[model samples]
Target: MRTVRVELGARSYPIYVGEGLLPQVGERARQHLPGRRLMVISNPTVLGLYGTILLEGLRAAGWEVLLAEIPDGEEHKNLTTAAQLYDRAVSGRLERGDAILAFGGGVVGDVAGFVAATFMRGIAWGQVPTTLLAQVDASVGGKVGINHPQGKNLVGAFYQPRMVIADVSVLASLPGRELASGLAEVVKYGVIRDAAFFAWLEEWVEPVLSLESEALIHAVATSCAIKAEVVAADEQETGKRAILNFGHTVGHALESITNYSRFAHGEAVAIGMAVAARLARRLGLGFSQEEEERLLGLLQTIGLPTSVPPDLDPEALVQFMQRDKKVRGGRIVWVLPRRLGEVLLKEDVPLELLLEILSNQA
Candidate 1:
């Protein structure tokens, strides 16, 4: 197992990435999390697949494990579902000393972490991510929350998990589209942070996509390390951390405008990166067409969406972006790439430029 540490001093935690880590989740949780009564939150689909083994492991480890299944999907990640979880926790008589175990993908992690952050003022939570997207991005940083009516992740908090158990083996069972969705974030890490990693991806992406053990483990570990570094530097997103949202401005807007059913989170981000590329070229940010093609080509190779849905209204999309949490002084902060492995935050992008870019990309 490759262990990456998020060095937050008092809040420091470890992320374990490897094959066959699922079966060891209970033992790991016992080491990191401080609680007896554990609430394992997941979706029906995931629970149906690995629930029995996971529960048995936890019980064997002496955890008073309770199962709370949230209906799967991004749309269900809202206050209603959180309220239902709240009901379960109250009825379960869970106390502040207990913890929550996020047992599915990003949706499960976000809502469960939110509950842990707010339930009885706060509680501990750990992540057992089953999807590549969650393993590489969502499950690492402390960002947790549900979607609001206006924007994605608008109502969220920075609640870090105690430990993250990312089992790459679970990814082999993912649908083709879901696996492709994760590669989008994997590509993001290269674009915004490490040129060497990006170059490595150019050569090794195929093997990683094929679930070759070495490449998969390396991808997950490297992605987690980059995020861990970013999160450690700007835990509250007050500065450098915004770089982590390189493709998220338009990405989140796309998810909001489409009601989140048309595209997965990483797919929307893939399209967002595509749009950002054009925006960078238009603004003379030194991103050449060749570089744009290189980035888009990687996404295309992974079967990720690289263009905005033609049916989405540009104005409505802009309206949703205005509601994004990154907006500062009423100006939407955009994390646009200057080149592969580097990004710049710009809040001065004109409305006309944004509209024109969206129109062209669409």
Candidate 2:
């Protein structure tokens, strides 16, 4: 097992990445979470698959566990769901010292974390992220929230978790599409900070996708380490942390425009990254044709879509982006790539260029 620590001083927490960590969830939780009272929040699908193992572990460790299951999917990630969880926590009598365990994917983590942040004005929570996207990205950052009608993740908080338990073994059950969705975030980490890692992915894509133990653990651990470093330096996204949203600005727009039903979050991000690369090329940014093809080809190889759906209205997409949280003072702030392993946050992208970029179907 490899551990990566997100150094947030008093809020510091460790992310444990390895295969077969699910059965040890109880022991790990006992170490970080205070008190014995706990609420395990997961979706119906995940609960059915691994809930018994997790519950058995906690019970064996002498901890009282309350199971709360929510419906799965991005559409269900809303204030309504969070409110329901708040009720569950209250009814379960979870005190400030008690902890909420998010035992599913990103949706579960976001909703449960938000509940822990708001319930009793703030309580402790931990993440047992089952999805690759969650394990590598969402589980560590503490950027928890629910999607609003206006936008994705508009209603959320920067509440850190007590610990993040990522059992890579759970990924064996993931559908191929779900696995590909996670590769998007993994690819983002490479583009934003690690050129060498990106190259390694190109060579070892097969093993990584197949979930070979060593490659999988290394990929998850490296991504988590990069995220941990960034979060520790800029916990609230005041400056440097914005780079973490490399493709999220446009990705979130696509999700909001489609109501999050048509495309998965990572799929939207894959398209967003493609569009961003094109925009960078148009503006004569430092990205090269070779780099663009490499990025797009890798995404296609991973079974991710690399273009916006032709049916969606481009103007509406632009409007949604303007409403993104990254927009500051009515200007969209984009994290455009300068090269592999480097990016810059630019707020002065021309509106005409953006509109053209979004409109171009090819």
Candidate 3:
């Protein structure tokens, strides 16, 4: 297994990546807290897929086990879902020493982590990511959140998981759309932190889409390394961590504009990245249309959307972005890539410029 450490002082943790990790969840987690109860929070689909093995493993470890299964999808990420989970934790008699096992994709991890953060004034939590996106992006950083009626991840917390277990085997069952969606996050890593990785991905995109073992491992590991460094520097997104939001500013706005149903999280990010790249060039940030075009080509290679949908109102999207958490008080902070692997957080770019970029998109 490949291990990456997220250094957060008291909340520090490690991420373990490899295949056949489901059955090892209990043993691996026991290293941190020798004897504590585990409440596995999973979505129904994931529970059906790999929950049994993990549950049995925990049982064998002599730890109390409880299961709270929610439905799967973006629609399920909300206050209502979180409240339901809180009720389950309360009913299950979760205590401070006990931890939550987030077993599923991004949605499950987000909800489960939030539950651990708020339940009984905070309890331990671990992540068992079951999807490519979760392994590469969502499950690594401590950005746990739930969608609100007004926006995506609007109602949430900055809760960190004690550990992360990414079993790549679970990705084989992912739908094509889901895999493509996950690649949006992969592309984000290259755009923000590794130009060489971006260049490599320009060629490896095909192999990754085909689920080649080496390509997938390299992609996930590289992305995790970038995230660990960012999270280490700024656990609460106070400064450097905002660079990780390269496509997320507009991508999340689009998610809110569409109510998180029209586009998958990564799909929206793909389109948002293309928009950001073009904006970088238009704003004379040492970028070019060629870079944007190359990005679009790569996204297409993976079946991800590279263009904004006509149905979404660009102005409405902008309005939503202005309300993003990154937009402190009144001003908006944007993570723009001046070139591949070099992202800068700048607040000077006028909001009109953002509207201009959105308006030009079809």
Local accuracy of candidate 3 as per-residue lDDT tens digits, 90-151: 88888777788889998999998888888888888889898898999899878898876755
Which candidate has the top score in TM-score?
2
Sorted on TM-score, highest at the top, how do the candidates line up? Answer: 2, 1, 3
lDDT agreement with native, every candidate: 0.89, 0.88, 0.83
Q: Model 2 segments beyond 4 Å from truth? A: 323-328, 359-362
lDDT of 3 at 201: 93
Q: Which residue runs does candidate 1 get wrong by more than 4 Å?
A: 149-151, 309-316, 319-328, 350-353
Kindly report which residue stretches of model 3 are placed more than 4 angstroms away from their true locations once superposed: 34-36, 322-328, 350-356
Residue lDDT tens for model 2, 1-362? 99999999999999999988888889999999988989999998998899889899889988899888999888899988988888888787888888889999988999999999999888888999999999998898899999888656888899999999888899999998889989899999999999999999999899998899889998899999988988889998888998888888788888877867888889989988888888887788899999999999999999998877778888888877765544555567788889998888888878788777777743
Model 1: per-residue lDDT, tens digit, 91-208? 9999999999999998999999999999999899999999998999999879999988865677989999999999898888899899989888899999999989988988998998
Clashes of each: 0, 0, 0
Candidate 1 backbone overlaps, count = 0
What clash pairs does model 1 have?
Answer: none
lDDT of 2: 0.88
RMSD of 3: 2.5
Model 3, total clashes: 0
Alpha-carbon deviation at 288 in model 2, angstroms: 1.7
TM-score of each: 0.92, 0.93, 0.90
lDDT of 3 at 8: 84
